[model samples]
Target: MASAPQQSLPLFYNDLQPLSSQQHADFKIRSADKAPFLAKQHAVPVTVEEFPLVQRFMPIVFSQGEEPVPLALMGLNEGINTFFDEDGSLNEPNFYVPAYIRRYPYLLARLRPDSDELSLCFDPTTDTVGAFEEGEALFVNGEPSETTKNILQFNEQFEQAGARTGQFMKELKELDLLIDGEVTIQPDGAAQPFVYRGFMMIDENKLNELRGDQLRKIVQNGMLPLIYAHLFSLGLMRDIFGRQLRQGKMPEPQLVQPTA
Candidate 1:
């Protein structure tokens, strides 16, 4: 069967051109400075492979609505990312950058709906990636260079990680573990707590209710720790809100959900 319609292109990719010798034989990708591309993004898609590392720094939450994919929350509100400075440079000296951000400009995508194959494509809009005299060559003498080879390998790994992430989400959905995630934080001296909603998270009550066999399967699949990591990472939502407050990017008051 034809694969599900492609997920919306990740943030920043405007157009995709299959990497080819015929079209881009001399196209070179210049290494740019820091990631200004991520400055406006508050969240980015993440995969299971990097969850362990990413959960250490950012809250790994699922997207709201059907077909929930894992995401690393960079900020509590939209249009604000706590990870970057005003100039769009990373503020944290030693934070682990997600592979999604690292694999920018270049991505593996399906060019045709009926085909299962993923084509290696890049964004032509990025100034760092184009036909240029300087920097790394995508093709060397009509053959993919070592740089291109390495990127292919990385993107391949990313695709595999994406597959595993799909399975993880499938298992969570089958077991009915996902629930609407809500949190209320009382900013220092604020009269009312800021209620945040519209995100999905693993429900602890549902998780605790799993049967022995079901629990065993989840444990054997090694999803238990990842679930806990997600739970633990929710605490950082407060920290992210604080970061936005300190940076003067605090959002306006949101409608509060009634207290239980």
Candidate 2:
């Protein structure tokens, strides 16, 4: 049920343009109270560093693919977000917003395929940053302002975390600890259970079957707790289903017949 953007551009970004003081010296980044871009985004790519906090708020699962990336599910189904309203305002306060969302409109990306260096980039479609009269200044006296510096620092940290998350995924694959994920939730008076699939999750059975040294290795390296966090957060699947049901976003039930 969780998938990242496979198109030419990343999720929520329509187009990317490298940020340069020459072209955008007078640009200012406005704080947005609402993020319409997140309204229909059900899953967002997350880093391993976010698992501890992400698990507390939403289920963390892997997208189904050859190179599966960890994703934080905002809703069980596509185009359904339980936490945010249609206007992209939080339905409830004090929610742990993912860094992936918080870093929107700005990201560090390699401008050239041949270059190993990454440049600061932003989505021009977003009104968050532009040549606006009011808001945080992006540059001061032809140099990056404090606001821009902070944004760069945050994006750098995010990239580092992304690398760590990639390593974590690689380790899971090497150990064969990931499996197809499925969740079945049956609400009271429902004719059939809601079966959610199309995602990957930790294979607890395989995890338990690992050799003692293998188990100890992961535990000592801190992967064990993250795995457990993912497993424990799965209980929130039912909670998400309930939210969809209450919000009238639940799709018509698809019943699976018993095999004769």
Q: Model 2's lDDT to the true fold?
A: 0.84
Instruction: Please write out the lDDT profile of model 2 over residues 53-171, one tens digit for every residue.
Output: 98988888898878899888888888888999999988968578988889888878876667888888888889788889899999999999999999999999999998999999999
Q: Which candidate comes out best when scored by TM-score?
A: 2
True-structure Cα RMSD, model 1: 4.3
Candidate 1 local lDDT, 49-132, one digit each (tens): 787888888888888767888888888777788998656799988688888888888898888878989888887778887788
Clash count for each candidate, listed in order shown: 0, 1
In candidate 1, what residue range of length 10 has the lowest lDDT sum? 251-260
Error of 1 at 213 (Å): 0.4
Off by over 4 Å in 1: 1-8, 255-260
TM-score of each: 0.92, 0.94
lDDT of 1 at 62: 87
